[model samples]
Every structure is written in structure tokens, then in C-alpha cells.
Target: MEDALWAQLQNTGLEEHDDKDRIEAESDDEEVDVQEELSVPHEERLQGPQTGPKGVKADHEYHQQKKLVTESKARAEYNARLLAKAPMTTTYLQDEANKDREELLILQAEEEEEDDLKYYREKRLRELKNMSRQQRVFGTLTTITADEYADEIDEEMGDIPVLVHLFDESIPTCKLLDEHLRGLSNKYSLAKFIRVSALQLEFDLVESPAILVYKNGILIANLVRIIDEVSTRFDIDEIEDVLTRHGALSENDLYDLPTNYA
Candidate 1:
């Protein structure tokens, strides 16, 4: 009986030893498999499961979600930068709108100012034309008698200047003065010019060629023996110089003369 028990015990110990060796071998194999899997590239490992339809769909979904997360992060960063640059979007937009409105108003004001200048320019031209037409109406010499002097010369002469030539038609100097007076009347249309016989004015025949200047119904100048007052012989220029010196003609009057007159 002792010999049989000893054999059974020896057999059981051998079987346990075999079972431990097998378990150890299997654990070593599993460790080698884990090491090989770790050695493979990460992309190849992912591709292994992605070869199947369900694995491929799961992989696509995972990449899609990752891409969405990355894009969302980038969008958030961009928005943060924009906010740092300009925190008040409404105020910034309002300022830009106000600047545009101001520029428009300034442009409109400039246009209005230009229009006003044009209008005034046209009005001034019309007034000048009307004045020029009025000046041309009285461009001739008139003959008057002593009886008509008050009505024609005195009362008729308001602020305008009047030139009266007292002469005898037979006098040589008187005839010369009459010719000059005719030309000056056309030249200086603003001044009234008239001729009367010296005898009609009760003046001496020796003073036949006399000149009288009147303004505002008052006799301002009386030049008797006109040849002696200027020279023995005088031209239109000398007569004009004398009249200008006496304030009968002014620079403004000369400037306002008709352009058609020489």
C-alpha cells in the first residue's frame, strides 16, 4: 500500500509542474505579442481596424470629430483676437457712419457756395449791362436858348455834370470849340453838353468862346475867354484836362464811358 501511494503523489506533482510550464509559455507568448503591437507605427495600427467597413466608418467619424474640434478652437482664437483689437463694434460702426455723413455735408456745402458765387456773378453782370445801356442814351450835344437854360440845364442837371458852350457862330475859336464839344458829348455820355449864343446870355462878344460847368443845378465854373484860359490854340485833350481839374469829369466817369466810343 505505501508503494502505490508514493507513485500517485509523484504523478500529481509532475502534472502540476507541466501545467505551470504551459502557463508560463503562454504568458511569454502573450508578452511577445504585446511588444510587437507596440513596435508597429501608430498609422499602421489604426489602418489594421480601418480595413473593415464598420471600423472604417468609426475611423472616419473619429477624424471628422477631431477636425471639427480643431476648427472650433481656431475660430475661437480668431474671434478673441478681433475682440482685443476692437472691443466696441457698435461704437466703431457709429463713428464710421458719422465720418461719412460729415464728409457728405462738407461736399454739399462746397457745392452750395459755388452755386452762390455763380448767382452773384450773373447778377453783377446784369446790373453792369443795364448801367451801360443807360449811359449810351444821352450821347449827343443839344442847342439851348437863354430862356430854356433854367429848365434844360439848371433843373435838368441833378447830380450829373453839365457843360455849356457860350459862343457866336461867326467866331473862329467858337466854331472849333463846337466841334470839340460834339466829339466830347459822344465820348462822355454821362455829362450833358449844350451850346448857346453868347448874345443870348448877355455876354460880351469878346468873350464869345466861354465855357460854363454846372453840377446839381449850381454853376461850378465859368471860364470866359476860353482861349486865354487854356492856350491860343487848344485840342480836345487840353479841354478835357481843364474840365477834369475842375471835377467836371472824374476817373470813374471816364472808366464808365461807352466801349464803342474812342
Candidate 2:
């Protein structure tokens, strides 16, 4: 009986060993089959994008737009830490505030300079542009029929030109002279443009349109019928030419020419 029991025990041990070996062999086969079926071909993977949704872009461009947002979040956290009133943060905040103040002052100064330029340009444009018939017909010309109360010509500030046009007749030529003088008033804001009749003049004048230019209370030129000689249809340029030639005025320097008594 003892021998039979021992024989049974030995057979059972042998059977257990065979079972273990079979299981291990089956597991190896399954592992091989899984690897063969689940893997992609190397060539197929090479044909597509390298990795992720990035589509093979440079490392720098990856999450580039989001970098700003993340950086902003980090800055906000840093600012919060600084405002928490630690000693180092207090020093950093004070320095940052001083830097910000300096930047603000620089920006303010630049803006003021820009505003000055803008004002100068606008003023120049208003003086030069859109000078048509209506605008040309009437301007800042001072009219003196006889001897009015008083004019600013006597108290002439600087070497500003005092142009007195003697046009008494109500004829077409006198009217044209009036139009020309009116246009000049707009162009030459620094100079005084005056229109006086024969009744106002001390000297006896025969011609209709006579112009007398004075500077610093001194006589410059007494022009007679020069407009009638220049052209029948006298425009602004011809008159400007005459004035520039006579040294009464030249091209307007806008801001450069000191108001000279403005």
C-alpha cells in the first residue's frame, strides 16, 4: 500500500510539471501573435506627421500663441506676490513704479510735441488751402473811407508791412483790385492790408488803383496802374509776384517768421 501511494504521488508531480510547461508555451505564442497583429508598419508611420497634432512644426512654434497667455498668468502671479508687502517685493515694486513714471513722462512729452506739430500743420493748411472766389473776394482787409476813428497802423509793432490801396472808383478795375487785396489779407496775416479812398489820401492822385507800401512808418513804394499793366485778369500769383519783387513779402515761412508784431 505504501509503494502504491508513493507511485501515485510521483505521477501527480509529473502531470503538474507538464501542465506548467504547456501553459508557458501557449502564453509565448499568444504574445507573438499580438505583437505581429497590433503593430503598424514602419513605412506607413514614416508617411504621416511625426508626432501629436503639431504636424512636424519647429519647436519654437509649438504652443507659441499660448505662450503669451501662460506668460501673462505668470506675470499676474508675480505681481500678486510683489503686492503682498514682503520687504524684497516692496523694493521691486518701488523700482517698477519709478520706471513706469519715467515712461509715462516720456510719452507725455512726445504727445505734446506731436500736438504742437499738428497745430502748426492745421494752421498752415487753413491759411493756404481752399482759397476760391468767395474766400478770395472777402478777407481781413481793413476799410477806411475817410479818416475813421483810429487804426493799428500808427502803432505798427515790428517791421510789418503796411499796404494802403487807393481805389476810389466803383469801376470794374477798382473792384478787381479790391478782390486782389482781400485775397492777400488771408495769405499775409503778419502784414496789414488796408484799403483807403481818395478822400483819405493827402496827395492828389489821378489814377484809380494806386498802392503805397510802408514799413516801420517809412514809405516803400507808390505803385500806380501796375495791376492794369500786369494783366487784364489779375490773379493771386501775379500780385504775389509783384509783392515779392518789391521786397514787401515773400513765401510765408509759417511758424518760422516771428509774428513780427503778430
Q: How close is every model to the real structure, measured as TM-score?
A: 0.46, 0.43
| Residue 131 CA displacement from its true place in model 1, Å | 3.6
Model 1: which ten-residue window has the lowest total lDDT?
253-262
Instruction: Give the Å shift of residue 174 in candidate 2.
Output: 1.5
lDDT of 2 by residue, 148-182 (tens): 51354565646677777777665456678788877
* Model 1 ranges with Cα > 4 A deviation: 1-137, 255-262
Give candidate 2's whole-model lDDT: 0.66
- Using TM-score, give the best candidate's number: 1
Candidate 2 stretches greater than 4 Å from native = 1-139, 148-151, 202-205, 252-262
User: Model 2: clashing residue pairs?
Assistant: none
Instruction: State the TM-score for model 1.
Output: 0.46
